[model samples]
Target: MEMSNMPLGGHWVLVIIMIILATWVIYRYLAPQNAKEWRNAGLIQGFIIALYAEMYGFPLTIYLLTGFFGLEIPWLHMRGHLWSTLLGLGDVGAMIEMIIGLGLVILGLLLLARGWSQVYKAQKENRLVTDGLYTYVRHPQYTGIFLILFGQLVHWPTILTLLLFPVIVVAYIYLARQEESAMRKAFGQKYVEYMKRTRMFFPEIKNWKLLFKKG
Candidate 1:
């Protein structure tokens, strides 16, 4: 029952509800720290809005697939689970993937929340956040965002999202570099030494012991 193809057609009300829920989450957990932070937040919000809008209000990718690419699957427009439909994964397989995706989203959000908590406290104390998730990845928040997007892609796999995903990743990489420059100015040699130990995004398995100890 949970894996049955979604009801045929879009649901504007559901889309609006999801957007409102997302807005509240961003407001409560991801409040921006400065002009640059606010701009980054806006960029993500814009991407999410476009994502969900098409997710429930309009199936643009499915439309393009059927309209231009000559997809002839009957009721393709009705079932909104595009990934399952496209891959011929029955409802059960799709449900399993959905569960994994949800777990990934939860893990990603936890990392983001924990990183934010540590950073907020560190900012107040004028101390660097090198413990917790930062012990491995210099940018746990960005890593978290990437994980979240990846989970979404696992379930959705829309062409529009696939195209935007790389662009968003590049943007975040550029933003992370800009952030590192400021950190260098603020912490000087200390920050440089930290960089030598930590990577920008992915965690070093070699530092797993350090992260476990610090965490």
Candidate 2:
């Protein structure tokens, strides 16, 4: 369903419901209590809600400019299938981008799931994680989010979304850095040693091969 249709065809009532639901979902996932974590989580939640709202709730910018776009533009059809409109795809290309975007979304979700599971397990034992997805990126959760957002952008590049993309990207990058600082402080010299061997967002091939080398 188009995001704008979340309120059932620009219905204000439905939009309110979506806002409530989004708030609940973000609160649950972010789980922020303290000041710092709460602030960070708020930023994350805001980014998520903003993206989804524009994605499925309402393409207001698109609709508002339809008159200027000409009568034969078929804005309704495009709004109904919002992603297709943004990606500039016609038929097969649209299908391809949609499939790819869906794939990336699934992959991002899986990465998040796996990363969360690992962290939860470590916390249960009061240990630190330096393996699995963590071995590849210091912040797989943020990376997954970026991947998901990128996938969405590729699938649908609306004016509002496009404008917000860079800002969102910068914000996430800042958050990731903040998280790394906390982690480094906690892990101390061990983390310092690990940093020498790990890349923040990209995996080092030599390290990967060494870590996976067969005895």
Candidate 3:
């Protein structure tokens, strides 16, 4: 297909449907019942909204930087699917990106489900959760978000969304630190012990590996 002949509007429609599905999933299944501090909720909500807007709505970043993309790419056109443009691939190549993107989507949902289950169970009983995915990462839900964004980056990679990637990482780091302080205060020595045993984002493979070592 000729560069100018490719249809892009359909891609936007797909993005819109995906965003709605994401919002519904979070609100219906993952939203916390315990009263979340307004500030923390607000920050998280803002991040989600920003991500959805660019992912589905106007796509400002893609539109604004059309020239650079157009000039740099020879066979591709800005009027094509945004994913293809950002990933620097053709239609067939974008099929691969879509497959990868879908895998990330499933991974994100699974992580979110696991994290939410742990958090909810703990919150209901008024206790700390340090098991399952929590045993693997202190903030699996945040990790889930990061993975979802990573997938979207692979899927779309618009300038605005791409720029927001590092911002999301830094924001999550700060939020995680603040959350840890609160968790530590709530759980005290137990949390301290858990912290000693667990690495925040990366796993402590040496210690984990020892569990499987033969005597």
lDDT of 2 by residue, 57-161 (tens): 666555655656642223453343444544555555657776887777666655655666677878798878888777777766665556666776666555665
Candidate number of the best lDDT = 1
- Arrange candidates by lDDT, highest first: which order? 1, 3, 2
Candidate order (TM-score): 1, 3, 2
Clashing pairs in 3: none
The clash number for model 2 is 7
Tens-digit lDDT track of model 1 for 76-141 = 333455667667875665676778877777766876777778888998998988878887889988
Candidate lDDT scores, in order, read 0.74, 0.61, 0.64
lDDT of 3 at 108: 73
True lDDT of residue 134, candidate 1: 85
Q: How accurate is candidate 3 locally (lDDT)?
A: 0.64
Task: Write down the TM-score of every candidate.
Answer: 0.85, 0.71, 0.71
Model 1 lDDT, residue 103, Cα: 72
- Candidate 1 residues lying further than 4 Å off, grouped into runs, are 1-6, 72-79, 206-215
Q: Which ten residues in a row have the lowest lDDT in candidate 2?
A: 71-80
The candidate with the higher lDDT, 1 or 3, is 1
